[model samples]
Target: MNYFITGGTGFIGTHLTSLLHKVHPKAKVYNLDIVKPGTPLPAVKDYKPALREGKEHAATFIYCDVRQPIELEKVNITPDDVIFNFAAVHRTPGHPDSEYFETNIRGAENVCAFAERHGIKKIVFTSSIAPYGAAEELKEETTLPMPNTPYGISKLVAEKIHQNWQASAEDRQLTILRPGVVFGKGENGNFTRLYWSIRGHRFMYPGRKDTIKACIYVKELVRFMLYRLEHHDSGVELYNCCYEPAYTIEQIVEAMKRVTGMNVNVPYMPGWLIMSAAGALGALGSPMGICPARVRKLQISTNICGKKLAASGYHFCYTFEEALADWYKDNNNQCLE
Candidate 1:
């Protein structure tokens, strides 16, 4: 059976492609994304060709945007083909609020519609814990989504759009995974920034050390996704994809230090000072992930629960420290390059 991955050129998508190659060596995988294979995104410049070396030649690249009606009439898609929906504008404080809904929500609708037309039985959707809100509460699969940001709201709506498609057919299978902050080699997000900050001795606690950030290694997340896709139960199944006990800011920092052998003392910086510095930088701070919105995010805890994923019988391949170490090694002993 062939595999189709939307947003397949992205950080998580690229890692997923690599992992799929390891598992299914001769798999006919198609990467459908707006970004071409050779062109790496500016933010994720470290995304190297070596990551998809052997698999790159095998997988087909399709230039398709999910926001519009997916025009894949020429491509051969069968009922057994699996579709992974990873398309979305996920970055916070990066795009206009309307951009989130325009891309994420419309993308989901179009993807589900395409699935219906092709009679694709299996679909894997990568959602976010942002739907559960950014509060310090422990979010579970059953938690009522109270999305505060446009991205979260769009994701939530997108989840329902996929769910509606699933409900239309009894035999169709849907696996929705709401992942936390996923970090690994190609991730240019929070963890990468943290690594750089610590290595450069510019790391400082935003306000408190106890702020919990639900996170998972990219490889581990991909493994779980594959496991579910291979041995999925009938009908719709949802899970919060994160470590069982999420790590606090202090714990995460300590893990990074142990893995990278960098133990510069990190002092807690006052919230007011950070805001003042951000204000002084004007437009400069936004691009550096230091704006007011991102600063506020640093203070809030994304305490998402992962009991369902844990109970799925999929063992975590890497611990927090081990994951960090592997990421460091993968990036040639650098901050994931």
Candidate 2:
């Protein structure tokens, strides 16, 4: 089997690619990213060497921009390949919203077009739980997408691109996975930000601590992706790829306290105070450049329902507490000290 992945250098992509290589030793694994495999980043030193170790020895690295048309002459994307579209401008503040549309939306369309034209058998897309927006209750796949931000809008648009392509093709199989905030090592998303805040001893309750955020560990997410690929009989399925039990913000912080043994100095800062402070900071544009937009995003609830996915016969490997403990165990000295 041959597999091609966009954004293969990303946190989830790297994990999934390495696992796939290990599972299928002889399979050709191609990684497509903006930077060459051996390129260095500030956060992770010798990232390329780390990515190339063990399972990825036989992996092929291709540096290309997916937004533009594929240069078949340079790197041939064949019909026999299984494509996984994991490339996107993921959560980061202050990034221009247009970048999300160009990359997430246009880039996804390009992938779908390439897959359909080249007769790729299967394409797995990584969608986000962001599309569900801030729901009052737990959200399901059947829930209407009411994306508030440009990032969420772009992801939903990208999902539609795959859906349209699947409708056009007769033999093609497409699986869309809407996973919650994925947490693990090397991931610096919302969950990581929270972990860092706690580790730095700056943990504070954001208004109410009852805001529930559905989460999935990297390992379980990869398992679900592999399972969906093997069980393609479902015919273009959309699964909420998340852990069975959700964790409230307070519960997660408490778990962090247990793992790190850090002094929890949570202050009950009023919501209005936070909003005002954020607004003032936005106006002043301090050295750290805190903004009200970011503050609003931080406060939004992202709870989701994973019953649909559970009913599909997928089981979660790590419980919420186990995942939290593993994260602390791995990064305790650095983050929890």
Candidate 3:
């Protein structure tokens, strides 16, 4: 069977594509994304040999935008193929309020429609834990989503769209994974930014050290996704995709220091000071990419729970420290390029 991965050039999509290429070498894998072939994420670049080489297993890149129904209709897909929907405007503060709903909600609608047209029965949707909002207590799959942000609201709505599609047919299978800050090889996100800050000795604890940042390594996350896909065949299933217990910002920094042997000399900065500086920068219209609202997240705890996933017999392949080491190794023994 073939695999259709939307948002395939993205951080998780690229890794998932690579993993599928390795496991199902004979299957035709199509990576549908808004990004063109030549411009891929750094993680995708690492798998170019296996993904773009003149091999049967190499993934085919298709320039497709999920927000448009016409663009999805252009893709040649069969009902037997599995679709992995990873397309969304995920980054907060960077996207306009309407862009989140436009891309995420509309994208979900279009993808579900495409799946219905092709009679595709199986779909895996990667949603965010943002629906849990800024919870200090650990959130689980059963927790009522109290989304406050536009991105979170959009993701929650998108989940319903996928669920609605699955509910239409008894044979259809849908797995919704609400993953926290997923970090690994191609992730030039939070973990990468933290690494640079620490290496440069410019890192500082923003107000609190114990702020929870629920996260999972990209490899482990995809492995779990595959495991769920192989283990479950029908019905709807939802799981919080993260480590059992979330890591504190302090623990994260300490793990990085221990794994990479980076000197930990960061001092705790008052939250008010950081907020004021960020606000001043924003008021002055400075090109400094610091958003006061985003900076505020440094102090907020996103304590998400993954007990349901862990209890489902899916063993974690990497601990926080081990994941960091693996990520470092994957980056060619460097934190960032």
Candidate 4:
């Protein structure tokens, strides 16, 4: 079997591509990404083994943006190949509103179009929990998606596009994983931002103490996604890819301290103070990258659950605690003093 992965150099994509290399050694692999080999996109560079292995094993890196299918038109894909679509402008503050829709929604349309054109029958898409939007209520697969943000709306649209693509064919299979904050080794965004702050001895807490963070380890999420793809029948199979009992702020802090063995001071600053400081820093060019938006997200609980994934008859290799330990071993933050 052949495999085609968009954003193959990304956190989840790189890990998934590596697992594929180990399992399907003889199969052809195509990494469709804008950033090619030798250029260590900061996030991809953190996973050193992936940087080396992806270059060696993948049949080719088709240099192109998902927005431009003309560039992908040159690749030798076939009907038997399975496409794993992960391309998206996910960093909330990094891009403008239109850029998100242009890249995410348009990218989704292009990928499905490319697959349909090539007669590809299987696609595993990584959607986001943002689609369900922020709510105090526990969001499951059945929860009506009322995405408020540009990112959330785009992801929800992408899911619909995938569903429509599958509906067009009787034999096509579509597996959509609406994952929460996925983090492991080499992750960026919230988890990595916190890890870096803690590692540098600059970690702090907000006034809110019990905010629940819905998250998944990258490895486990990928494993579950692959399992669903293989086991589920032709048609749309959607799963909210995260743990049922999500971690609280206290739990995450305790785990981080235990894994890193660091005694970083954790002081509780009022949300107003933290947000004010972040806003002031942003106005002053944010040398420390103090993000006010991140501060807001940290304060709220987007309590999500994966009831469907848990009932899918697959065993998880690592729990949140084990996941922390595993990454801590490889990270440069473990402490002795």
Candidate 5:
């Protein structure tokens, strides 16, 4: 078996590629990324161990932009390969809206076109929970997508793109996964920011402590993807990849305190004040790397139902407390005193 992945150097992609190598020893894995292998990239260091692990086992790396036209002759991509589309310009508070549309929307179209042209039988796309937008309770797969931000809108659009392609190509197998906030050993974005802030003893809580955050560990998400690959007959399935139980803000903070053994202060800033501050920061070119659009997200619940995935025989390995303890133990020295 041979597999081709886009954004293979990314957090989820790296983990998925490593697991694929382990499970399918004779599989030929090809990773296509904007950054060429052996080149300096934003999060390359985080994926070093995974890359080395792949090299020790057997994997190939290719540098190419999925948004652009692919030279199939040069890359040797054939109809026999299974492709995983995980490349996209991830969410950032201050990112230009054009970047999101170009990469997330147009880039996804390019990948779909490539797969369709090559007659790739199976294509797994990594979507996001953001498509369901802010909800008061657990959102299900049948809920209408009310994307609030450009990032969420783009993901929803990409999902539609995949659906259109699959509809046109009856032989193609498409599995779209909408994962919650994924965290692991080398995670970045929200998880990294929160981890660093808590470790630095500078963490602060907003007014309410009841806000729930839906989350999934990276390893568990990868396992689900591999499971989908083995069960290709599942057809065009969409599953929410997250833990069965959700965690509230207070619960997460308590877990952090337990793991760090530090007396971290949780300043209760007024909700209005936080929103005003976030707005001001966003207007001033989005300093602090915070996205103004996500300010509302701080107040809303992010719990999503994963029963559909569980029904597909998927199980989560790490509990919230367990993951936090492991992270703290591994990053004790990086924490601020």
Candidate 6:
């Protein structure tokens, strides 16, 4: 078996690649992305590689942008290969509005086209909870998407493209996982930023204490993706990948303190004031690491459900607390300011 991945250098992609190497040791894995996973992760003690069919696998990283089908054209794709598409312009504060579409939407098109041309019918794509937008009500799989940003809209569009591609062929098996704020070791995004904030004694509640954030551990998400790929019963499937009973920011803060021993009695900062400040910063090109719009986003709840996946009988290995503990255990020495 051969595995092909787009955006293998990314945080989630990096973990996915490592886990795949352990589970399918002999299967040749090709990572088609513009960059490598960079510095090798310190090997975990007692790491167990997946031993299936008495074979092991290896992974090879290749520089290829998903926007150009020609870049994928040269790869020796075959019928037994599975494509995992994780490439997207997801950094909320860094990229332009157009960059999101050019990469996310167009990249989906190129990937779908390549798959159709090569009869590579199996695909697992990672989308985001951003598509559901900031809903006051809990969002389930049936929720009508109301994407607010270019990134969210592009992901919603990409989901449709994958759906259409699946509809065009009877043999296609597509799985679209709309994940929330994925966190774990090597996740240098929201969770890690929070770590530094707590360590620096700078963490403050942004308005309310009950602002819910949906999240998944990187390894747990990858494990589920691989499980679905191997034991899939065919047909298209969509699942929101996140912790159930989504934790509040306050809960996350407490978890950080418990896991990392970071002490911070973060005070509440009003939303309006933060928004106004963020707006001013946005106007000044957002010099501050925390943008005003993002400050506003922090106040909103990203409530989402993984009921569909849950009902499918796949048990998640990590809850919010367990996932936090896992990260702290892995990065025990790196939790400081």
Instruction: List model 3 lDDT by residue over 1-337, tens digit each.
Output: 8788888777788788778988888888888887754453443223232123342324688878888882544456788889999988987766779999999999999999988988999999999998888768778888899999999999999999999999999999999999988888757577777887788776678788999898999999988888988988899999998887888999999888888888668898898887788788888863334568767877889888878888999888888889989988876776642
lDDT by residue for model 5 (159-248), tens? 999888888867778899998888775565566667566666545565578888878877788888888877776358899887776778
Residue 225 displacement in candidate 5 (angstroms) = 0.3
Q: Which candidate tops lDDT?
A: 1
Full candidate order by lDDT, most accurate first: 1, 3, 4, 6, 2, 5
Q: By TM-score, how accurate is candidate 2?
A: 0.88
Please identify model 3 stretches exceeding 4 Å from their true place. Answer: 38-57, 70-76, 283-288
**TM-score per model over all chains:** 0.94, 0.88, 0.91, 0.91, 0.86, 0.89
Query: Between which residue pairs do clashes occur in model 2?
Result: none
Per residue, candidate 4 scores C-alpha lDDT tens digits across 121-228 of 999999999998877888888999999899999999999999999999999999998888887765655777787777786667876879888888888988887788
Candidate 1 stretches greater than 4 Å from native: 42-58, 283-287
Candidate 1 residue lDDT tens string, 1-337: 7889999877778888877888898778898988876565675434453234443533578999999998785677889889999999988877889999999999999999989988998999999988888788788899999999999999999999999999999999999999888998667688888888888777688878999999999999999999998788569999998898988989999888887888689888888897777666557735444567777888999999888888998989888888889998987886554
> Against the true structure, whose TM-score is highest?
1
Q: What lDDT would candidate 2 get against the real structure? A: 0.75
Q: Which candidate model has the greater TM-score, 2 or 4? A: 4
Off by over 4 Å in 2: 37-58, 72-78, 283-290, 332-337
Q: Model 6, 212-290: lDDT tens per residue? A: 9888888889999988987785688889988777789998889878877766678887877767777787788765356
TM-score: model 1 vs. ground truth? 0.94
Task: In model 3, state the lDDT of residue 171.
Answer: 92
Per-model root-mean-square deviation over C-alphas = 2.3, 3.4, 3.7, 3.1, 3.7, 5.9
lDDT of each: 0.84, 0.75, 0.82, 0.80, 0.74, 0.79
Among residues 3 or more apart in sequence or in different chains, the pairs in candidate 5 whose N, CA or C atoms overlap within 3 Å are 93-291
Give the TM-score (vs. native) of candidate 4.
0.91
lDDT of 5 at 72: 50
Query: What is candidate 6's CA lDDT for residue 103?
Result: 97
Model 6, residue pairs in steric clash: 22-50, 23-50, 24-57, 25-56, 25-57, 26-56, 26-57, 27-57, 278-292
